[model samples]
Structures are given as C-alpha cells and as structure tokens.
Target: MISYRWLLFIVLFVGIFATNYLAMTVKEPLAASAAFTLMVLSVYGLEKFYNRGPEKVTDERTDLINMKAFYYGSLALIVTLMFEFIWLVSEDYETAVLMAKYLLMPFGAMIAVVVLSKAYLERVM
Candidate 1:
C-alpha cells in the first residue's frame, strides 16, 4: 500500500489536473473559479490532516524545503507568465488570460508535490 503522504500527493495531482482540464474545456469563469476553489480547499484539508493538530509546529528543514519548492515553483510560474505575455502580444489578450488561469492550479500542485516529496525523503532516507 502507498503511504498516506503519497496518497495525498496523488489526490492533489488528480484534483489539480481535473481543475485545469475543466477550466480549459468549460470556458466559463465561474466554473473555473469553483474548480480552483475546490482544489485549494482539498490542499488545505490535506495539510491539516497530515499535520494533525493546531499546536504542532513546522521544523527548520520543512520550512527550508517549502521555501525551496516555492522558489522553484515561482521561477517556473514566472517563465510561464512570460510566455503567456508573449502569446498575448502575438495572439490575443483573452487567450493569454485563459492560459494563465488554467495554469494556476497545476503550478500550485507542483509546489505541493515538490515540498511533500522533499519532506518525505528526509523522513525516510
């Protein structure tokens, strides 16, 4: 059986992927927003469940891994935004906005995966 951490990651991955796919296919702002919200809530719930209690605190290594994940994810998001900007200039603003909106969930999911993987590796090996 997969560990709880890996199961959580898989759930997050699927949620983000589904959200992005829905956003792309539905082409409705409200629908996209709802999907995004669901993804965010799922992530928050996972974090809460994994952490177990309000009084528990994060360690330095966890903080560092999270920071590194954010750094890398931000870098990737920036590049994607730049590409979207180029697309906007060349194609149309609406298209670029749609692409960017669709990207947000996956980018967030990527960050979660990276941080969790780092933490899991630290714990196991």
Candidate 2:
C-alpha cells in the first residue's frame, strides 16, 4: 500500500518534472502545468479507491462527532467561498471567470465533503 508521504512525493516529483519538461520544450507552459495538476489529482483519487480500508462502526457517538466536524468544515468552506465571491465580484467579467475556474476545485471538494458527511450523519444520527 502506498502511504500518504510516498503519494505526495510522487505527485510533487511528477509536477516538477512535467513543469520543467514543458518549460524546456513548449512555448507556453500553463497548459502543461494545469494538465499535470489534473493528472495528479486523478491519480490521487484512483489511489483512494484502490487503497480504501475496512469500514468502521457507525454509532451515534461517532455520528455526533462527525456531524460537529462537518458543521465546522462547512463554516470554513462558506467563509472561503464568501471571500472568493467578493474577489470575483470586484473584478471584470473575464477576470471573475478565471478566478472562478481556480475556485471550482475547492468548491467541489467542499460540496463533496458536505454531501458525504451529511449522508453519514443522517445514516447514524
């Protein structure tokens, strides 16, 4: 099983190598870098599925704790979304669109966290 540290190192190394390769071989490197990021994230996602561990008990106590953590995480995500929204609104439409593109991943992650955590909370609580 690949541990977190090794996964991190592998992603980091591939990112650096891909970036350097693009810099040396391509006229523009942004697309290559962005592609590398998506690739790395995809790999990490596959790793999660491949290395998924055993299930645990879903008792009320665990649900309560998880619910609290989800609430806090949601609050944090809300704050970040607010900040990004404000920043996006302050910019021109083109700039706002670009900014939103960068924010999309975190927003999606927050949505996933909320969905999964609430699912678990509802299942137990």
Candidate 3:
C-alpha cells in the first residue's frame, strides 16, 4: 500500500511544478505538467526499487552516526546561510529575488555535508 509520505512528496512536486509553471508564464501548461508528473513518478518508482531490501534495524551505532551526520549538516547549513546573508546584506537586494537565488548554496551545502558525513561515518564506524 502507498504511504502518506509518498503522497506528500507527490503533492509537493505537483505544487512546485504548478507554481513555477504559472510564474514563468509557460505556454504549454498541459504538456509541462504531464512531463513533470511523469518525472516525479519515475523518481518515486526508482526510490522504491532501490529501497526494496530487508527491513532496516537501527541500533546505537546507526543512531549515533545519523545524529552526527545531522549535526554536521546543520552546522554546514547554518554557516552557509550566514555567509549568504552577509553577502546579500553587504550588497543591495531590493527584493527577495536575489535572496531566493542565493538560497540554493546553503541547501547544497547541507546536502553535501549530510551525504559525505554519512558515508564517512558508515565507513569508519
């Protein structure tokens, strides 16, 4: 049976797609929405396929690794966000348009930190 998490992701994808489509004033909304939906479904399917394994058993070690990874990721996110804020404030940002463009850096930093930290922790611990 499908889970609520999957439904939430699908809804988020559709909402994001619709928001961007409307904002960009795209001509072919139908085709774009169909393609976006297909892409989201394909990714969801791929994740499901990849996760078809035995049920996960978490223990102290696994929990510690995850905790540390999240800690590092949060640190990286905060640092990057601080830097982004400083840079933006040093310059001139009339609206949130420029701030929106800069937001990806912190997000990428967080993801990179989490992935790398998890990989390293898994290997070492």
For TM-score, the strongest prediction is: 1
lDDT measured at residue 37 in model 2 versus the true structure, 0 to 100: 57
Regions more than 4 Å wrong, model 3? 1-12, 21-56, 68-94
Kindly list the per-residue Cα lDDT of model 1 for residues 1-125, writing each as its tens digit: 67778877887787656655554554444454555566657766877777785664778766765565666566667645643444353445477778778877987887687768777867764
Q: Residue-pair clashes per candidate, as listed?
A: 0, 0, 0
Worst 10 residues of 1 by lDDT: 82-91
* lDDT (tens digit, per residue) of candidate 3 on 27-58: 44444445545555566576677678996798
Model 3: pairs clashing at backbone N, Cα or C within 3 Å: none
**lDDT values for all models:** 0.63, 0.63, 0.61
RMSD of each: 8.2, 9.6, 9.8
Q: Give the candidates in order of lDDT, highest first.
A: 1, 2, 3
The collision pairs in model 1 are none
**Over the stretch 9-67, how does candidate 2's per-residue lDDT look in tens digits?**
77768765664455445523455446455655666686677679986868777767567
- Global local distance difference test of model 3: 0.61
Candidate 2 versus the native: TM-score? 0.38
Clashing pairs in 2: none
Model 1 residue 98 CA deviation in Å: 10
The true-versus-predicted C-alpha distance at residue 112 of model 1, in Å, is 15
